[model samples]
Target: MNTYDPAALECLAAIVEEGGFERAAQRLNVTQSAVSQRLRALEAQVGSVLIVRSRPLRPTHAGQLLLKHTKQMRLLRADLERDLQDLAPRSPGGARDEERISIAINADSIATWALDALTPLARRNLPIEIITDDQDFTQEWLRSGQVLGCVTTLKQPLRGCRVLPLGAMEYVAVASPEFAKSQLPDGLSAHNFRDVTFICFNRKDDMQAEFVARRFGLKRVSLASIFVPSSEGQVRAVAAGWGVTVVPELMAAPLIAKGLLVDLAPGFKLQIQLYWHSWNLESEVLNALAEALTHAAGQSLVA
Candidate 1:
């Protein structure tokens, strides 16, 4: 398009992220009709369809390109605002030079040791907002500009982003004592989980099954399972002897210490190496937060 319509590109991205024109309008504090008009104008300017209107909208490839560019623009704008505020000589406690740095992280990490890993930053008074979700999809939030940083399984960084390894998170197969005594076989093997039920965080969570399969050298977990979406509830169900589960070492540690759960295999473990992914921009806040995270990870995670 001859004219670079930042507002229109933003509206298009919101429509894709928020799932509807009306919702995007609400987010933009504008009328739904206005959002529609902006999309139509942009489509005419680009001479291509940007979206396919459905229950939850789907963006065309052209739309994704513009969305990526829009996100980069937003991140740059945030960095600029922070720099401008720094030049104003404003008070420290005020909003000057302070904008929320939204980050995506795994729920297990947030509820377990990761928060402690962030304690150093809190001690320094850094302002950050954490978004908890399945680690498998954490990178999506980065692409959508919903978060500037993420702890994700993807080793490589996303477009306009950089990645730094934060060290590995370990998980072990665990279950209630009663479940282990009753549901498990006399000598249980990973491939023999067909007889026992398993508790999973959600369909997207494959940690438990993957652990089993890897131990047995199988391609995948072929077992009966139950899905529990909540992080706390999943732990509770496993503790209640409803089924077996695989949980992070930090999450299972306290309960294991309290005798609420039993380790199926004392030494068997799965370690997922986490990385810090964020926009490759120079900002004092982001730089400070990154330093804090690196330092925290060094203390909390194994070398």
Candidate 2:
């Protein structure tokens, strides 16, 4: 088997994560020329282009494979650190930025149960990076090897990965009391839903349209959208009477009870089943994360 240099692999990962040679050099504490030289050596070793020189740096297929290997190495290091902590107070060098584990989670989950799930690990000073995207799209991070795991809507496990059911998060449509009184007095119905603006997470979010179509039995539905790009921001916008939004019932509950917002569709709730997908690796850190998330999710999400 041909062995590749670990430093060269790390150089590739740093370039992609930091977005440029200069930044990668700064992060790695090396000269820009050294970073470029390392990358050139790696590409020559692999006999393929490892990075696409785009507005934002992106990894090629071979680059992604190497990156994943690098991450697995990082996980192994974390395990070694934990095991050695009892014998030695601290490692000679602390965790590096390159060792930070990354995961993709939906913003709704992040705004609700997910942060609580991650609190224990964070408190222990586990180096982690949370990347938020729409739930339906989070699996792409796993597929691209950019993240070792993700909380996503995809039920099926990706190749070389394992999946665990995290239960369903219920979604409900909500608006401010004044907005409800003024724009949807009788609440959302087939007859009146089209009359108001719908606040969406982003252009990629179709939850608003999907809920309307499912509730009203429409073959196709279109909504007047105002993009918020944030889970909490969408609720804040709705409460300020900008428009209505569909949000996690967990987040909507306290506001609804406080009269800050009103449920627009009483009987219409959307249940989004969530799943946790992780690489099939025997890593203690990954297992601990899964345990924390699944335990917290069990308490909050609907079965």
Candidate 3:
């Protein structure tokens, strides 16, 4: 059997996480030379270039595989520690333990309902690190081992991962009552869309454009739009009559009830089915979190 050094592997992971050699050394409480030497030795043993030497260090493909192993090892170790603690006698002055769970979620879910699902875990003192991305793209974070789990639009699980279905989140095109009256007097047709402005989450967000194309059967219609990256800010901008935008039904419901906004197309809606994807590990904490999230989704999302 070949021997591998855990400390050296840890150094590589630290470098990637910290985004620099100096920061990795500081985190490991070692000298910069020691960190360099260890990485060199590990690279030699592995016979591959593990990292790209850049201003902010990045891991090569080989390095990412090793980093995935490192992260898995850490989770297993934490599970073991928790089991051992359960067997030990309780003491008032015992060290307070907190497990770290890294997950990726879409901005819309986080802004609307996912945070409530995680509240129980937070109350139990579990430290969760959330990486936010578009739901369609969050799977990339899981594939790269940047996060152990993610809330995504992917129904198919990644290799060695399990998936749980979270119901669909509905969205509707909405505008302020005043804007709807003025800008959409002709009532939303292919020809009139050019006159209305839109609010988008970002340039990468194509949901609004997709909705328009699907509804009007007009491909590649470039309507005027302003980008507001924040979810709440997007709603606020639309409410202030900045522009019409697509918003989650849950978010728009309250405002619509109070006459703050009007549904531009009452019959047309977009529903995105979401799923929870996680590594296939027998982790109690992860299982509990998944259950909580699924239950929360059941309550908040459309079946």
Best by lDDT: 2
Sort the candidates on lDDT, descending order: 2, 3, 1
Best candidate (score: TM-score): 2
lDDT string for model 3 (91-142, tens) is 4333221134678998889989999999876655455778887788889888
- Assess candidate 2 and give its TM-score to the true structure: 0.96
After the best TM-score superposition of candidate 2, give how far the Cα of residue 210 lies from its true spot, in angstroms.
Answer: 1.3
TM-score for each candidate, following the candidate numbering:
0.82, 0.96, 0.86
User: Would you give me the overall lDDT of model 2?
Assistant: 0.91
Tell me which of candidates 2 and 3 scores higher on TM-score.
Answer: 2
Over 102-218, each residue of candidate 2 has an lDDT whose tens digit, in order, gives 999999999999999998887776778999999999999899888889999999899999999999999999999999999999999998888999999999899999889888899
Alpha carbon lDDT of each predicted model: 0.76, 0.91, 0.83
State the lDDT of candidate 1 residue by residue for 116-219, as single tens digits.
76776555444556887888888988876666788888998898888888888888888888888877645358546788888888778888778888777888
198 in model 2: Cα distance from truth in Å? 1.1
- Please report how far candidate 2 places residue 284 from its true position, in Å: 1.1
Alpha-carbon runs more than 4 Å astray in model 1: 1-3, 84-102, 116-133, 140-147, 158-160, 185-188
| lDDT accuracy of residue 101 in candidate 1 | 54
Q: lDDT of model 3 at residue 114?
A: 96
